[model samples]
Target: MGEFLRMRRSQLQLADVGLRDFGERRRVPGLRRDELAQLAGVGLSYYTRLEQGLSLNASAEVLDALARALDLDEVERAHLHDLARASRRTGTRRRPAPERAGETTKQLLAAFGDAPAIVLGRRSDVLAWTRTGHALFAGHLDPHIPDQPDQRPNTARLVFLDAHTRDLYVEDWPKKARDVVGKLRLAAGQHPDDPRLAALIGELTMKSPEFASMWSEHRVRKWDLATYRMHHPVVGRMQLNLQTLNVPQEEGQRIVVVTAEAGTGSAAALRLLAQAGTSSGAGSARQAARTARRP
Candidate 1:
């Protein structure tokens, strides 16, 4: 919480909050702790303690006032509450049970059919995907890899470390990368004790300098819907709309469906890709049957 507050504070200026400097040399950027405390109707020392992590028992009213003073949006306010709740917890950190796509989730994926869709866990792990989802998003990887927990693809890892994924976004790769980092930031605040999540963050920080830099910025974002321009090696270029739907039954699981406008070239490309995926799947099944019969 202290880190988050400090980062937000640094982003503001006197002019932003109706304060004027009298040409005094100020060492710190943005509003000072005293200024912010005054704005939030709290004592300077009390606000300082909160920002220093010395006070963890702040009430919701206080948090809301501080959030308002900082000009946080709805998602940012929710994230602040999440961080506060996490800090108030006691006892040892517990590892959450591994997340999986339930039967209902699988059915939902099947319902999407040739439309590209994937199920993602809290940490953005690929739990399951439709055939065309695999084809459109990661045709270079093994189609069955998501079935193996140990080999599952993490979207965050792919965006930062995988060369193919970097090329997948024909433009706005940085925006996509920032979105991944921001979501991970929100996840980290919500699940501060999840060891696997901590490990994933550590690995990315060490492996990718860009990831490390963005992670340090302390940005938080929630994915809803977005459009991306993509260039697939097999299907060519496409402008696809991505929508994320949360699975209420399975906490932290979300269904991401990608689509292209009807009658557009991108939609036609998606159909061609789906057909190729179907043909390849059938050919593989035939090869497997032949091998079994020979043996």
Candidate 2:
């Protein structure tokens, strides 16, 4: 919680908070700790303790005041509350990783033969993907990425590290990256004790400097539907609307479907990809059946 507070504070500038720069040289980025405390209407000592992790019983009113001072959005405000809750129970027992996508969810993906669809686990691991799904998103990479549970290509990982995915996003790469980190922030708050989640964050933070910088922004987002533009190698420039469906039976698992507008060029491109996926042969069906077996 303290680290998060510090990071959020560092992201603000004097101008952003309506403060004047006296043209004085400053050592720290963004607002200083005392400046934030003053703006938040809290005692300097109290706010200091809060940031130092020495105080953990802040009231809702105080948090709201600090949140306002920080100019946090709705999702960021909720994430702050979650962090406060976790801070209160600092010594709780760690929980296991959340459950994977259920058979029903995989079946749902399989049923979407015309549209590209995929099931994503809590840590953004690609649990399973349909035939058109693989061709649309990760066809350039290893086709068997979703086959191995232990080594499945995590969506977050690919977004940051894969060259092919970088080319796919082209101009809007940063937006996609921010969305990934924001969703992961919500996931991290919900599953604070999951070692796998912890490992994934740590690995990305260490390996990708871009991920590290974005993670420090402390942004949080809850996504339902988002439109994305892609520059596919084969299909050319196109746009698709992404719809996310949560699996009620499986915790932290969601199915994402990519669809284009009817009678549009984007839709034609999607159809082309689906048609090409048909040539993947009997092996595609076998892979779908194997993925369905994973409860």
Candidate 3:
């Protein structure tokens, strides 16, 4: 990867940007080749050979070592892999995915209707969902809506552009918007070429000033913990702790669970509310699923 990229022979010299310590009183542009090599724990000559395109056969381990030294993130790491594959003239056709959430996760979600549990796809698409999860995650305007891709209440769009979400949250709508935009930014960086994701971003950018402003900040991240107040239809006003668990074996999928303290009216309200639209939701969801599988 290094050798092939080096072969490009760009006019701009880079002996300044990655210097060990700002290249105090230095002459050239970015970090000198040896500096990069030393920082990467690689031999100066060997790294020079890599930079000069004399050697392009560095293994994955070597590439990873370099990436770490340069502070490359998940997206950057994946990008490095792509560069290496392209350099090697290898056609990287990924195996067809046999990947999906297992029965255990589905069961776990079904059992966690204590508040709400929603499973989001890699790009925040509403995938399989629990009953209350749909209502809690998105207002239950209509159970039949999820049947159409256009009708699904995307978490990103809702938090950023929807008037209902803006009005529904009792506090910190800006904070929530930032979090949603930040998560989407992270996903965008991680999956740069995803058409659906690209489309979603384009839509948001065109539609919402808040989203457009937040996205430009380049703060790509995830939501590990979030607590917020909300007005629930089935219940009323409540405070819930939103917990997120990345589903194991399901790459890019997450189970978001909301909870309230036990013995409180909030907890009772949550439980009752979760059951409020469940049975009918399940029937509708099953029907939708069956329809989807039909020819």
Candidate 4:
């Protein structure tokens, strides 16, 4: 929370909030603590304690006022509340049980047929995926890998650590990376007590300088719908729209469905890729059966 407040404060200018420079030659970039306190209609010392992490008992009214003063949007305000709520929890952190896609989710994936669809846990772990989803997203990986809970591929890790994922987004790779980081920030705020999440963050921060740099910005976002241009090793270049659907029964589980508009070249490319994925899956099944018979 302190880091978030400090970063947001540094982004504001004197003219942004109706404050004059007065030629005083300020040392800091944005509004001072006292200035922000005045803007939020709170006591300077109280606000200072809040910003310095000395006070976690701030009321919702006060947080709302601060959010308003900071010109926070809906998502930012929600994230602020999440952070505050997390700060108030007191207990030993527990490692959460591994997440899985339920039966209904699996059935939904099957219903999607040739469409590329993947079920993701709160930490962006690939809980389950259709055959086309595997081909479209991580075809180089073993298609059955998600069956092992301990070895599920994490989207954030793939984006930052895997070369194939980096190459997948041929255009606006940085934008996609930022989107992943932003969603992870929101997840961290929501599950501050999850040890696995903490480890993931630490691993990314230690391994990828770009992840470390973007994570420090404290950007928060929820992925709903977005379009991207991708270069697939097998399918070549195509533009696809990613739609994220939240599971009502399971909290923090989402299904991402990939699609392309009808009659477009990208749509035709997706059809071709789907056919290839089906053929590959069939061949893998046949090979497995042959090996089983030999054994």
Candidate 5:
């Protein structure tokens, strides 16, 4: 809770909170402890203890005040509450069990014929993908990565680690990267004891400076309807709308579908890609099980 609060506080500027500067030299970024305390209507000593991790048990009203003072959005507000609740717990956090998509989820992916869709397990693992889904998104990589549990392709991993994926989202790569980090932040809060998730974060933090910087910002976002401009090596440039739907029966599983406007150039490109996959026998639902090196 303390770390998250501190990071968020640093993200704001004095001007952002409608405070006038006295031209005094200050050391820290954003609001200092005293400024934050005044804004949130709390004592300086009390806010200092909270930020220093010496205090917990913040009441709902106090939390609300802090949330307002920090200008936290809905997702961020929820994350703050979750962190506070977690801090008051006494027992050790348990490890999260591995998760995978079930038969019904696979069937749902299959039903999405021309639409590119994939089932994402907990930690953003590629549990399963429709034929077009494989062709559209990850066809450039070793296709076998999604088939084996141990070597499954995690979207978060690919976003930061794969050169091909980075190229695909060339124009808006940073936005995509930020979204991935935000989603991971929420996932981490929800599953604090997941070792694999922790390992993934640690790896990215070490391997990618961009990931490390964004991670420290403590951003949180809910993955839902999002649009992106993609530069596919095969299909060229196009805009696609992505919608993420949660699998209610399974915990931490979501189906992401990507589509374009019906009559746009992007839609035509998608149709061409789908047709090519079909002509090469790569569009069959059964073919998703077989691995094919991208040509």
Candidate 6:
């Protein structure tokens, strides 16, 4: 709660990006605390207390008005609203993790040929993957094992907790973590009834001190344009562009496709991955035939 208030303050600062974004280049003093108070239709001292999170009981109407007064963009406005909701449950009991992506979804991942694809559950759990995808993106471990209620290798958990994450990402690891937290924050707003999201928040707050500390900051990130520099063992270094595909056929699922620019070493690396995948597919086909004959 203390952190979320501070985050709201940052959003307020962003409203005057010209001055508050950086102090050195400011000509005007930007909005004085009183000016913001006027915009929010609240007292100067009252707004100040709210910004400080001195009270955990801001009404939905006040929050809505404050967001409008601050000129919060859609994303920030939503985040401010979410913090208000979270404050409502400071002492309440929470629920269980939600249903994850299913087997048909996993089969789709397997069919993507050389493309490295991993299906993630809401909290960014790596639910399923293609053998080639695993070989490309996360070659160090097996994917058949399900995440324990607490031990799930969620991208957020892994980025913060796993040492291997640092090696896997070339740059922008912090940005990615921020994106994870930001997206999760947004999800929390949409599914206020979801106990699993609460559990994820609780687990993250407890397990990773960095996450706990960052969660306090309340920074919200919109990942509409998320792209990463993917590092694959077989593909060497491929600049894979990421496109998040929403398939309504699979509820609570998003398929991420990783593609490289054509005619580069990455393309050749992709070919090698596809060839390796073909061999595995062949072996599986033979095994299935043998099992059918056994009956």
Query: Which one is best on lDDT?
Result: 1
Which tens-of-lDDT digit does each residue in 229-269 have in candidate 4?
Answer: 99876656778999999987887899999999999867866
At residue 127, give the lDDT of candidate 5. 88
Tens digits of lDDT, candidate 5, 1-295: 8999998899889999999999999899888988989999999999889888889889878988999999999899888888887777787667777777788888888889978999997799998887678877888755566778888988888999999899989998999999999999988887777889989999999999999999998999897998999987666778999999999889889999999999997887676667536445544322432222224
lDDT per residue as tens, model 1, 1-295: 9999988888888888888879998899888999999989999999999989999999999999999999899999999999999989998767788889999999989999899999999999999999889988887788898889989999999999999999998586998999999999999988888888999999999999999999888889997998899987666678999999998789889999999999997887777767657667645544543443363
Best first by TM-score, ranked:
1, 4, 5, 2, 6, 3
Candidate 4 lowest-lDDT run of ten: 284-293
Q: Write down the worst ten-residue block by lDDT for model 6.
A: 14-23
Query: Runs in model 5 with CA error above 4 Å?
Result: 142-144, 278-295
Tell me the RMSD of model 6 versus the true structure. Answer: 8.2
Residue 176's lDDT in candidate 3 = 77
How far is each candidate from the true structure, as Cα RMSD in Å?
A: 6.4, 6.8, 10.4, 6.4, 4.9, 8.2
Instruction: Give candidate 5's error at residue 63 in angstroms.
Output: 1.7
How many pairs of residues in model 5 come into backbone collision? 0
Q: What ranges in model 3 sit over 4 Å off?
A: 1-104, 147-150, 278-295
Model 2, 5-55: lDDT tens per residue?
999999899998899999999999999999999999999999999999999
State model 2's lDDT: 0.84
lDDT winner between 4 and 5, please give it.
Answer: 4
Residue clash pairs of candidate 1: none
Clashes of 2: 0
lDDT of each: 0.88, 0.84, 0.66, 0.86, 0.84, 0.64
Compare candidates 2 and 4 on lDDT and give the better one.
Answer: 4
In lDDT terms, how accurate is model 3? 0.66
| Cα distance off (Å), candidate 3, residue 67 | 11
> So what's the TM-score on candidate 1?
0.92
